[model samples]
Target chain A: MKHTLAVLVENRYGVLSRVASLFARRGYNIDSLAVGVTEDPTISRMTIVVRGDDLVLEQVTKQLNKLIDVIRVTDLGSEDTVERELALIKVNADVNNRSEIMQIADIFRAKIIDVASKSMVIEVTGDENKIRAIEQLLKPFGIKEMARTGKIALRRGPKSV
Target chain B: MKNINVYEKYDQQSDRMTGRTEKMTGARAIIECLYREGVDTIFGYPGGQVLPIYDALYDSKIRHVLVRHEQSAAHAADGYARATGKVGVCLATSGPGATNLVTGIATANMDSIPIVALTGQVPLSMIGNDAFQEANITGITLPITKHNYLLQDANDIPRVMKEAFHIASTGRPGPVLIDIPKDLTTELIDFHYPETVKLRSYNPTYEGNIQQIKKAAEEILRSYKPVIYAGGGVISANASEYLRALAEKVQAPVTTTLTGMGAFPVDHPLFLGMLGMHGTKYANYSIQESDLIIAVGARFDDRVTGKIRSFATNAKIIHIDVDPAEISKNVRVDIPIVGNARKVLEDLLKYVDKAPTDDWLQRIAHWKRSYPMHYIGGKDNIKPQYIIEQIHEACKDAIIVTEVGQHQMWAAQYFRFSEPRTFISSGGLGTMGFGFPASIGVKVARPDKVVFDISGDGSFQMSSQELATVVQENIPVIIAIFNNGYLGMVRQWQELFFDKRYSYTCIRNSVDFVKLAEAYGALGLRVTQPSEVRPAIEQAIASGRPTLIDFWVECEENVSPMVPAGAAINEILDLERKA
Candidate 1:
């Protein structure tokens, strides 16, 4: 099972390496990981997509709690959460196919960040499924370039993630 | 770009502990607590950042034993904890010294020995700046330690310190590191010690689950060929009675891990010699062929289990351990009853029916008769194995600690330990420099108990700097070095697998061990003949203070009944012994 754990940690230099090392030593894999600062300057939240069974994730969470820098871990898959991922897809779209791609992007409420004669950069933000759907639509147009920020999550209602 | 708040622990008007307010620095408060905790002796080394703590120590009544290396402090602390049940304390400066303590801390962790390690950190402002002599000691030690604390503020000292000792000594028992920023130790604050720790996340289940206990009981009662595989947990949990009861009730044989040696009396019929590499042949075979393996507090380490795939392949495995990380981490357990080993065993014994198994007992007896743990170096010449056995005979009740490599294994193999905690070695971490300091810790813990450190020449050199600490403290510990002049384990590997291309295994500049001991204001004995073994050991033990005995033995000797790397436990190699 893939678990998306959004963790808040102190911005220590080797904090990421410690987390990665823990996963590596424990024989677990990180599917995707993204780290960015939150409102609190000292605290940087990391969104990590890890592959493990429920039991493995529970053990991993317990071990991570032992790390001084890691404050808390939230498994978004098991909770009612708002998940977002950003991707800049440079599509190989000529003038003719650019209109079709723009129309598809408009349906998903994705923004056209950049446009050139040979390619158009489509910026999309959504949950994993929505992002995958958008990427599939742009695949036929020949993806020339791409960059993705892995899933970032926040719990719903009056609660802190 | 951002406003920096003056980082401070909440200075409540009433104080953390109600009704008392006394001004003191974190350094002073910690020293006061240590004094209150009855720590008369400390093993440590001074440094630039920890100078304030040393300054406080001078004013305090405690006697500090300065070691040549910081790593020695940690090992001494570990040895002390094992010797005495109290928390062993050691202190070191920031950065490299803290990193040097890693081997000792990990050694303590692997053996489940309780230790309190103190490290100085850079000033709070320069923590992440990578300032001079600043390393993330807390971060470096996180994975190996049970718990660690970074003291950023002065006010939280007493509470943090008291809890550090508490957590290190409680539950499964392991090492805890406390990294103190130099500035905080010097900063004055109102001292307040919280009576209780309000850690919501740490709710350790000490008594254990009744249902799982019942399941363990059911499994034990149903099995015909039962074998009890024990480890350091028995000693850590103080569950000797529980172990005896379970063994007596079922008529099962008990074989312990290398660290678990003294948990059960070696003379007991149910007690099989220590299992795994160089273990009793029958013990390993019995555990591998048993119908049910009741592994109490023993993590199926690679050395003990050999290849995990075929480790007790046909048997039903019921594992009981306090640490949750142990469960399913290596070999999957059919029944993982997680809790304190003593409590869980006691709880399981409650549900067990009084059914005696004469069949299992008979089979174990047969196996023992067929393949016993024995080696006859039939030659009359002095050998390391003979000296270890002679020393064992001399100090039957004494606590024996060992450094890593061949001698450690030889001591484990030859020393017939019949008392609990009598044999202490760095089993898991295999730290080469473990013995002398550990002996110091042991001697400090039990002043009345005789302590002997079985050291290999190569391994002893790593931390022998503690010779100064031993002399300074005036604690008597006999260090018997099996002087093979080679890193015996590595030498064996080189001879067998690497076609005898000896590299760094040889000790190029051999020190006269007798002169070495004399230099440290201790007695030294050099034994070259078999007749000299017993006399030298007796004289050294009788000499009072620290003593070292150098026994010149054959270097080509190999540890037998070893399961080579990545091999199954049953596939053991019995190396040919010299006739």
Candidate 2:
């Protein structure tokens, strides 16, 4: 099973490294991780996607809670969450297929962020499925480069996670 | 910052301060903070990078014990912490000195001993350049420590010191590190120790949820075969009294982990000796047959859970610990109470309904009588068990420490501990060179108590150089060496499983421990006969100086009731049955 956890931690220099080191030491698999400053500048929020059985996932959450810098850990897997991932993909495009690529990008609500004579960069923001769909479609166009911000999440209701 | 607000209040309530703020170097700030935190003793070895801190110590009232190796400093500090329940402090230089403390730090971390380790580092500019004596200690120790800090500026000293102590002494209580660069120690800043640390995310749960305690108590009442599995957490929380009360109210047999030995009185009728790999026959059997297991303050390490799937096959486990991560980490728990053991046990006793377990006690007594720990006696050869038993007879009240190996297991098995904090050893990391130096630490913490380190020959040689530290500092600790001429534990495995291939197991190398002790200007005795054991121990105690007793124990004597690796605890090989 895949689980996403929202971890609030002190915005210290090695906080990320400490969290990463724990996963490494315990041999837990991390699929994706996105970290950014929260409302409080002294605190940061990390959205981590992990794959494990229920027992392993429970261990991961409990272990993260044990870290001194970690303030809160909420498993978003069971909650109604708004998950997002940003991807900047550069594809090979010529004069002939440029219009078709742009139309497909438009259908997905993505934007053409940058362009060159023989290539164009497409910016997409969505859930993991949408990001994967666009990446698969652009693979046929010979992707030149691609970068993803992994997955960031927020709980849906007034209650904070 | 949270600290700035705290300093405002401290300034108004200035009983111990001359002024709200005073300019001082970072080195002075570190010493000042230690004084404010009530630290009177520290174990450390000085080097170039830490010269500023050591020089600052020169003018302070704190007494620093200089260990021969940085590792001893850490182990000694760990021993001090375990004995006194205070956060032990150790200082070291960069690179090798910092790295040397790794094993000891990991040892303390595994057992959840509170410690504050300070290491000197290269200046900020030289950190990544790999200058002389530079090491990324904070990075290396991240996985082992509860928390760590690398100081970027001198102004961060007061806050960092407060946080280090707060984080170390709270929660589950493990080692914390503070890496101070050379320049930071010399840099000047206004010193005002933070009065309180308000870390929003670092609040530890103290009291267990009342609902969980009620549920656990109901389960206890319903159980016919109940057993109490206690661990180091009981000792850490000082909840032995509560545990004893709970056990007496329910009449459940109590089995303890190696680290949990002294937490419960071994002589009690319901007390089963240390459980796990080297645990007693009765304790292991009790766990295997129990229907309900109340696990407190213990993580089920592999050594304790012989075959995890088959361990306590019939028991529904109720785990109580301060750290939530430890509850179901190894064994799947039914009732998990995330709180301090003392508080949880106290609340748990409220909803308890006493049940009869006379039949269960009778069964356990039968097991104890049938599978008692025993060894054959030889006419001329002095047995290691005999020596340990004799020591137990002579000094039952003494605090005992042991290095890792057969002797450690023998000490844990034979020397019964009746009081908390009396049996201190490296239970989690199983580090070999830990006992001799740790005995010094125990002695330092309790000057009125007798301290002895039961050590093996190979283990003793690893840190025997600490004898110089003991002699020079006038630490009166006794080290009883079971000199069997080999690393006995490994040799035993080889003898049983490896078709008796004694590859490198025979270390016939000759370095007389008596002469070695004498060279350090300490008393030394070599005992070849069993009769000399008692008199030697008596003389060492009466001499009131650092002493080493070298007992010539027999070879090929293995610890029995052994569960070979990967076997079920119930399928133990007893002394009468050879593998």
Candidate 3:
């Protein structure tokens, strides 16, 4: 099972390493992790995707709470959450395939952020499944390079972590 | 001087009006924080990086014991902490000195000992440059430490020190490290040690959920074959009195993990000796046959659980621990109460009554009688078990510390500990050479008590250089070396499982421990016969000096009533049965 956790931590040096080190040491598999400062600059929010059962999730939450810098951990798995991931894909684009790639990107509401003589860099933002679908359609065009900003999420309601 | 006094008075007034802020160097602030924390002694060895701190200590009252090795410093602090239930303190310089404390830090971490380790680092500008004696100590110790800090500024010293001590001594206590750059110690700042720590994320759950406690109580009252499985948490929480009361009230038998020894009175009728890899046959049998197992302050370690699937198959388990993560880490429990053991047990006592366990007790008694711990040796030959028995007979109230090996197991088995903090050994990490120096720390902590380091020849040699520390400081501790000419535990494993291939276990005719003791200006005794064991112990106690007694015992003696690795706890091999 995959669980998304929204963790609020002190925005201080070595805080990331502390959280990451804990996951590594305890053998918790992290699927993806996105970290950035929240509205309060002194604090940072980390959206972590982990694969585990209820027991492992409980342990992960408890262990993360044990770290001194971590303020709160909420399992966004059960709650309605708005999640987004950004990916920049540089595809091999020539005259023959450029129009097809543009149509696929348009259908997904993705944008062509950069264009070269022989290639185009497509920018896509969506949930994990949507991103995966677009990548599959562009696979035949040859993905020259790809960079993904791992999933960042927040609860749909007004409650905050 | 007059201007300074006036400034001091004004500073005091403003501080009293505002808070406790005093102008001092970071090094002096560190000492002041220790004084505030009521730390009386520190074990450390100084080097170039910590010179300013050493200089600051010149005017401080805290007694510092200089160890021969940095590893010994950490172990000594660990021993001090175990013996006194206070957070022990150790220090070291950068690079190799800080690295030397790694094993000791890991040892303390594994066993959950409360210790604060301070390491001197290279200057801030030189840290990542790999300057002389520089090490990224905080990075290296991140996994091992409960928490760690690398001070980037001098002003953070007081708060960091306060936080370090607070973190080390609280809830499921473990070692914490504070790595300070050399320049910070010399930098001056207004120091105010925080009166309280306000860590939003680190509050430990002290009281168990009332519903869980009620369920656990009901389970206990309804159980007919209840067994109390205790561990290091009992001692850590100082919950022995509550544990004993609960056991007696429920009329349940109690079995302890190796580190859990001394948490329950070993002489109590309900008490079953240390339970686990080399645990007593009766303890293992009771667990196998138990219907309700009440686990208190104990994680079901692999050694204790054996094959997890086969462990307590017929039992409904109630696990009470302070750490929530430990509740189902190794084994699932029907009732998991996450709180301080003492608090949970106290709450549990409110709703529980005597249990119906007469038949269970009778069965346990039968197992105890049929499978008693024993070894076969004549009067002339000194069996290691007999030596342990003699030590128990001689120093009935002594604090027993042991290094890791077969001797450690023998001491754990043979010595009857009736009080908490009486038996100190490296239970989790099982680090060798932990005993002798730890004994020094124990002696320092409890100067009035007789301290004994039960060591194997192999283990004692690991930190034997600390004999100099003991001698120079005039700390009298008895070191009993069980000289069997081989690493007895590993050798036993080879003899049983590996076709006796005996890889590198033999260390015969090594440095004579007796001369090694004498050379350090301490008392030395060599005992080869059973009769000599008692006299040697007596002489060492009487001498009131650092003494090491080398006992040449049978080389092939193995700790019996053993469960082979990965086997069920009940599938044990006794002396009459061999694998």
Candidate 4:
């Protein structure tokens, strides 16, 4: 099982390495990790996607909380939450397939951000499943390159991590 | 001139009204911070990067013991911490000096000893450039330390020092490192040590949840066969008295981890010696048969919980630990109480009622009698266990420290520890060269008590250079070197499991320890016969000088009642069974 954890830590140098290394040292793999400043400038929020069972999740959360710079950890797996990921797919495009790519992008509400003679870059933002869906549809058009922002999530209501 | 003088007087008055910050170099500030923290002694060796700090120490009153090796400094500080229950301090220069403390730091970290290790680093400008004697010690120590700081600015000295001590000695106490750059030590700053530390992410839960405590108490009362399994945390939290009270009230037999040797009175009828690998047979049997295991301050370490799947299969476990991460890291628990051991035990005592375990007690007593720790005696050759017994008979209250090996296990098995902090060894990391230097710190911490480092021929040689430090400082710690020709533990493993093809385990007597002790101006005694053990121990104590005794014990003696790796704790192979 994959767990989406929202971790708030002091916005300081080396804290990211501290957290990343903790997972590495403990033999826990981080599927995806995105860190950015939170509402408070002094605090940073990291959305981490990790694969583990309930016991592993509990250990991960407890261990993360042990770091002095870490302030809070919230597992959004069971909570009513909104998860989103952004991806940009650059695909091989020609006169014949360009229209087909655009049609697929339109259904996902994605945008064609960049276009070159041989390729077109489509930008998409949605949950992981939506991004995966769009990627599957555009695979026939030949994806030149793809970049993903991993997964970031927030509670469904006003409650914050 | 008159107006200027009046202004200066007013400024002085205001400085007195509010707490005044003193202008000093970062090196002086470091010493000042230690002074403010009430530290009177530090173990260290001076080098290039730390020269400024040594110069500052010239004017300070803090006593610094110059160790021959930087690793010894860290171990000495750790020993001091374990003995006195205060944060031990060690200092070293950059690069190799800092790296040498790595093993010692990990040792302390594993056993949860409170130690503050200050390492001098190359100047900020030269840090990444690979300057002379430069090392990123803070980065190197990250995973091993509880927390660490790289002091970039001189002004952060006071706060960093305060926080370092606070973090090192607090809940689940462990080593913390503070790397000071060379330039920062010479940089002048206004220093005022902070009185309080408030780390948002680091407040430990000291009190257990009342409901959980009630549940634990109810389970204790409901179980007819209960065992109190204690560990280092009992001593770390100073909850030995509470643990004893709980055990007595519940009428449960007490078994301890190796590090928890002295947490409960060893002589108490209800006490089962240590449990796990090389633990007493009765202790392992009691834990196996118990219906309820009130695990206090003990992590279910692999060595303690042999074959985790089969460990306490029929028992309900109540694990109480200060660190929540340790609650279910290895084994699942029935009731997990995350709190300080002393506080939780105190609260638990209020709710726990006397358990009905007479039949269980009788059964445990029967096992204890049937499987007592035993070793075959030789007519002329000294047995290692006999030597340990002699030491116990000689100094009943002495603080026994040990270097890692078969000798360490023998001491754990034979020596009777009656008080907390009396038996100190590297339990978790099992570092080989811990005991001798740590014993130096132990003696320094408790000058009134006798200190002994029970060492092995192989283990003592690792830190044998510390004889210079001990002799120079006049610390009268007796080092009993169990002189077995081979690395006994590994040799035993080979003898039992590896077809006895001794490869590299035979570390033959290369250096004469007696001569080495004499060379350092300390008394050196060699005991080859079994009868000479007690007399040499008495002479060492009476001499009031640093002494090393080389006891030529039976070379092939093995620590027994062993649970082979990955076997259940109850499935132990004793000497009789092995024979």
Give the top-scoring candidate (lDDT). 4
Candidate 3 structure quality by residue, lDDT tens digits, B277-301: 8999999989998999999998899
Where model 1 places Cα greater than 4 Å from the true spot, the runs are A5-18, A34-47, A52-62, A65-83, A88-102, A111-123, A133-147, A152-161, B1-19, B36-38, B128-130, B377-379, B500-504
Tens-place lDDT per residue, model 4, B1-579, is: 134564455345334534677677899788878877889889999999999999887756677999999999999999999998999999999999999999999999999999999999999988899888888888899999999999889999999999999999888999999999999999989877777997888898899999999999999999999999999999999999999999888888999999999999989999999999999999999888888999999999999999999998889999999999998899989999999999999999999878999999999889878888898888888888888999899989999999999999999999989999999999999999999999999999999999999999999999999999999999999999999989989989899999998989998778898999999999999999888889999999999999999999888888888999999999998752111
The candidate with the higher lDDT, 1 or 4, is: 4
For B1-579, candidate 2 gives per-residue lDDT tens digits of 134554445434334454478877899889888877788789999999999999888756677989999999999999999999998999999999999999889999999999999999999988899799888999999999998999999999999999999999987999999999999999989888888997887889998998898999989999999999999999999999999999999999999999998998989999999888878888999999999999999999999999899999999999999998887888889999999999999999888867678899999999989988888876678888889888888888999999999999988888878999999989889999999888878889999998999999999999999999999999999999999899999999998899989888777557899999999999999999877888998999999999999999887788877888888887788753221
* TM-score for candidate 1, residues paired by index: 0.88
Cα distance off (Å), candidate 4, residue B374: 1.4
Over A1-161, each residue of candidate 3 has an lDDT whose tens digit, in order, gives: 99999999999999999999999999999999999999999999999999999999999998998888999999999998899999999999998888999999999999999988899999999999999999999999999999999899888888876
The alpha-carbon lDDT assigned to residue B3 of candidate 2 equals 41
Task: Give the winner by DockQ: 1 or 2.
Answer: 2
For candidate 1, what is the DockQ-based docking class?
A: acceptable
DockQ for each model: 0.25, 0.88, 0.80, 0.83
Using lDDT as the yardstick, the better of models 1 and 2 is 2
Single out the weakest 10-residue window by summed lDDT for candidate 3 chain A: A152-161
Q: What share of the true interface contacts does each candidate keep?
A: 0.04, 1.00, 0.79, 0.75
lDDT of each candidate versus the true structure: 0.82, 0.90, 0.91, 0.92
1 or 4: which has the higher DockQ?
Answer: 4
Residue B346 displacement in candidate 2 (angstroms): 1.9
